[model samples]
Structures are given as C-alpha cells and as structure tokens.
Target: MMISLSRACVLTAACTVVLTACGGSTGTGGSATPTSSVDVGKASAVTPLDSATIARAEKQGSVLLYTNADAEQMAPVTKAFEAKYSAIDVRVLNMTDPQTFQRYATETATGVRTADVVMATDAVGMLNFVSKGNVLDYSDPNLKNLPDYARLAPGVVAMSEDPVVAVYNTALIPKDKQPKDLKSLAELSKSIKGKVGTTDITNPMSFGSVSNYTAKHGDAGWKNLEVLGQNSGVESGNGNLMQKLAQGQYQAAYFVAGSVRALIEGEEAAKVLNYTYLTDGTPMLPRAVAVTKKASSPDAAKVFVNFLLSAEGQEAACAGGFTPYRDGVECAYGLPAVEAVVGADNMMLGGYLEGIVKNKPEIVTRWKSAYDR
Candidate 1:
C-alpha cells in the first residue's frame, strides 16, 4: 500500500520497501552501484555515485520527501529505492503545490526539522524557492546526463515530463467528432458549450499549460483559448475534471493532465474516457525536485535525488504511470508518444517561472474575460 504523510501526521506511517538484504563491503545495499554503467539511451553517460556518499547516506538512514505527486504514483519509485538501499528509509509527504511551499516555509522559519527533499509542479513557486536560497546547491553527477532543460536551476531538476492533454467521454463524443488539436477543441466547444470543461487558470499548473501554448502560437493560440473559454466549464485540478468527464457531466476536458489516466477508477469510467495529446501543441510540465538546505539527512537526500535521475529509477517511475522523458525509456504516455502524435516541435515545455510571474495577472485577466468566469 502507498504511504501518505501530511503536516498533521508527519512520519506516522511508513511503507518501507525491503526487497533484498544489504550486501557489499561498502554497506550500501543492492547489486547496482551508484555509478554502474548501463545503456544511457539518449544520454551520453551515467553519473557515478560516490561510494563515500552512499556510505554517508546509509549512516543518515532516512530521507523525507515532500511532493505534490499523488502517493499512489510515487509508491513504486519509493519502493524501488528502498529495495535498492535497504538501510535508508524513504518517507513521502503528499500535499498540494501551494501547501507544500507554505508548509515548508513555515517549518523553515520555525527552524523545525523539515523535508529533506521537495518536489512540485509549480514553476514560479520553485523559481522563488531557488531564488530565496531555500534549495541546497548540491549538483548531482547525474545532472550532466539529463537534457539542458531538465536542469531547471543550480539544484533543481525535472523529475518527470507530464503532458497536458484533451480527454473526452467516448460515449458522449463520437470518434469522428472528438478533437485532435486545440483548433478542433475550439470548434467542438461550440457544439458542447458549457458541456466542455477545462482547468481553472488560477492553479499554477493550469496557468502554465494555457500560457505555454498561447506564448508559442501568439494570436492564433489565444484565439483557440478564447473559444474554449467561452464554451468550457472549469475545474481546479485534472483529476476532478476527469471524474466529471467520466461521469458524463462534461463531454470533454481540454488541458487535462495525461498522468490522470493512471488514477482513473472503475471499468465503466475507463471504457468511456480516452485522452489525446493535442496536435497543435502538447504542454509538457516538468515536475521539479530539489534538496533543501536545511535537510536533516542531506546525504540520503542526495542519494535519493541521484537515483531518481538514473535509468533504473526512470523505469520504476514509468511502472508507476509517470510519463518518462528520458530517452529509450518508453511508456504509452511518455515524451516519445507525445512527440509521435504532435511532432517534437509541438511539445511546449511549460513552467518558466520568470516569464509566468511577470505576465500572470494579464494572462489570468485575459483568460477570465475569454471564459467569462
């Protein structure tokens, strides 16, 4: 079972993954070395893990991760990490992006033992975090292996590349009528009107997705959104929108997170709901992860962060339903799939905090006016 922690119940539950016994002279468990060479796929080389660092991390024994990722989605990766490093206990605290930031801030202010690591999808918030010197400046060796965009800041890195997509109830919208791109979605909106749904731009992720596309297509992009806004209802999160879509409350939802496909429950809902990456542009939100300067177990946190960027870790994340962005690690919802449908040029990378922060008010106002909400 997935273990979920919150501010109110920190460290109350533990779901440790103990797949094998600790071995090796270094006392770091598992067959794979931190620097073990493997087929890097698109990457040129794998970063070697320092044996001394691993030993230090083992001594630290525990690492606490505060993230916006759903507990269920993170369980497999956490389990895999623990199975490899049996001595290190991994604890995940799940919260909203806002909550994660606020809670960490409060804890930091109070000089309390806070999260060893943090992960969130809000680019602006993360940029602020980095600017405030909240993140540790420990650059992992794996940083060199990832794409340039993956390195968001000195310490922060992209944990996953999740695409925002259009999801529809198949029973309500015929295959012929379903949208293939934002333009089609805009056209379909006229027929569906309020029956069409979209994310609330107030949310950072939602704003990032909409703004990213609009930034790329200029007037044409805004035109598409203007049409969508006039016709669509709004939800705060993709999961809620998906639930409504599956229930037939909304015939379709645009800019829904493709990752929500894993959270869909019930056979009936699964049969009715289907998603597609918009052909015009698919906004890829790279969830960022960073270690904190105040981490109680800094060494362990470094180990965990390095593992996340490793090939084995990417594979484990894929198993947990995240869209892996690393080369050669294929998932139906991965970067390659989106690229295949929309073309590489159309994959819009969202969450540039600096730009978003500057233009958010105007964007939100324009979005509200377009949607009349």
Candidate 2:
C-alpha cells in the first residue's frame, strides 16, 4: 500500500534532479555539507524576522519569492498575495529545481538573498535545512487544521498543489495509446517502446515514484519501468519535458503539476499538449515548499507555507489534479482516485523514492541494457 503522506511520513516539498557531489553521500538520508565558515544557526543578523522585518523588507510593500512554478500560476498567486497585503511587494523568480537549490545555498552562505519565500518540491533541500536546524520553528495558527501529509515538522511546508502528472501531445499519441492503470501502463510499454520520455535518477524525487511503485507490486510494479527505461528520449527535468512536448519534439512526458499546468495554461503551450491523467493512477507529488535559512520574511513565509497545507490548499490541489498530502482533502476536482496503491493503512509516499536512491539503479540499468541486447 502507498504510505499515507499525512500523519507519520516526513514530507518533502521538492525533488531535485541536477545533483552536485556535495559533502554528504547521495540518498534519502544524505544532507548537503556545511561548506560555509560561519555557523548558520548562531549567526545572528539585524533582527528577528517578524512583522517589523516584513514591513521594512516590503519597502512599504515589496517581497520577492523564488519558485520553481511556471509563470502563469505564480503570477496569479503573487497577485492574490499583493491584494491581501497591499504593503507587501511580491516578485517571483522562476528556476528549475537544481538552479533553485544552488542559488539558495549560495545566498545563504553569502548572508544575502532576494528570496523571501523559497517554494519548491525539492525534498533534499528541505530535509537538508530542516535537519541542520537552518529552519525556524515558527508554526502557523491555521496549521493545526491542515491534513497530516502537508506537515513537514514545524518548519518546511508545501504551499501549492503540485502533483507529478502525465502529459501527451494531443496531436501525436492517440487516446487509445494511453494506459488506463498502472498495470496496463506497464503492458502498454511493450507496444510503444521508444515513444516515452522521463527524468532519470539525477532527478531523484519526481521519477522516484517508479521506485515507490516497485516496492508495492514487486516485480509486477517494475514491469512498467522496464518500458520507461527503454525509452529513446529521456530528459533530466520536467520543464524541459513540457517544452519539448509543446514543440512536438516528443509525443508524451510525465510531468509535475506546476510544469504541466503552467505550460498548458500559457498561450505558448495550450495549443499543443494536453495533460492526460493516467487512468493507471494519480502520480506522486512532484512539488513542495521549504523556508530558506536567513530569510528576509520569515513570518510571511510561514504564513504562505501554512496556507498551502491548509484545507484551502489541499482542496485547491485536488481541484487542480495534484493529490493533497494533507488529510480530508477529497479529490473534488472530478479527478481520479490517488488512493494508496500498496496498502490501505499506509499514509506516506516517500519510501519508494528513498529505495531508488538505495537500490533501483542496478535494476534500471540492467533493464535499460536489455533493449540494446
């Protein structure tokens, strides 16, 4: 059974594919080494990050948010925030997961950052900071009402409903070609051998679902991956995947909710690719949020992360196609059931990702070489 993300599992807000050989070993438990000379924890700054800091940082009302979300969705979210706190100036900078992490780590070490809120699904970063005590333990009042999966201790939290979703260029693949279930999808892989594309281990989290699926179904679950591994066109990130799909460079791609929704809604991509929800099952969460160390607007950041995990955020997630990690979030968007596949009692989806970092590569590599044979 897929573990229930709420209650017990340590939730990760973002997944990164572009990895560096940082001090820590790579895996679910590995953390980024402290490369800076100063102790980030005791290193005090000007003052506490409270309303006063927010007011000052606002410059009467200006705040910058660094996000991995596509511009279209973020634009409106930014506008909503500005409308609520007119004194807050919000500027959002978009980057891939890798760029986002590198920039944050650099900025944190340098003692300067443009990001008031660092939003992402990169769990490695979230865990790195949270475990190292880089995060502030401030909790939002509304947080208690949130579902369990959305909780990432008292610190990092995901504020958006970014689910990893499957997408197809409507112009290229026929509807009949799409898999109706995880089992069927694996079977279908044999038919369309070279037409699929996805991220690799470098992506760790997003494609980690493959490993998660394997744990549940054993060899049966991995059958689908045997097909994915054989694909002729594999990419490192979802943004690239969407762009390629938009241009008709590839017929189908698995995606995070942000990239899919961002592109499909933008005038640039809506004309080309359509998100095809796998009748096979809902994809694992492809996105999440984390508070950076030395943030300029810690309270507001706390508020924002809390909002994403609240009932409001989870419902919004269900409506948008991303599964809500928090509890009581019914998939009211007429979306498919993202019910746990492994067992009914389980609540989290992170183990499979960890498993991949630990074991799946050998299997995937052997599986990949089979096509050559």
For model 1, residues 1-373, the per-residue Cα lDDT tens digits are 0112121121111112121321112101211111213332464466757999999999999999998777767889999999999999999988877787888899989999899999888877788888889899888898777777888887998878887777766667754567788898899788888899877887766877878888889889999988888888997776566556656678888877656555432233345555667778888888888999889999999999998888778878877767677776645556765665677788886335446767878988998998888
Show model 2 residue runs off by greater than 4 Å. 1-61, 243-249, 255-272, 307-373
lDDT of each: 0.73, 0.48
Worst 10 residues of 2 by lDDT: 7-16
Worst 10 residues of 1 by lDDT: 26-35
Model 2 C-alpha lDDT per residue in residues 1-373, reported as the tens digit of each score: 1111121111111111111211221111111111123221221111223565455544534455676654544555555555656766667787766677668778877877656666656555555546666566655555555434545545655453333456655456544455434455445555666666666544644444554455556676565666666753666665455555545566666533423443343332333444543434344543556555677776566545554555555455444334444544454221123332212222234411443334655755654453343
Give the distance in Å from residue 178's predicted Cα in candidate 2 to where it truly belongs: 2.6
Report model 2's TM-score to 2 decimal places. Answer: 0.66
Tell me how many residue pairs clash in candidate 1.
0
Clashing pairs in 1: none
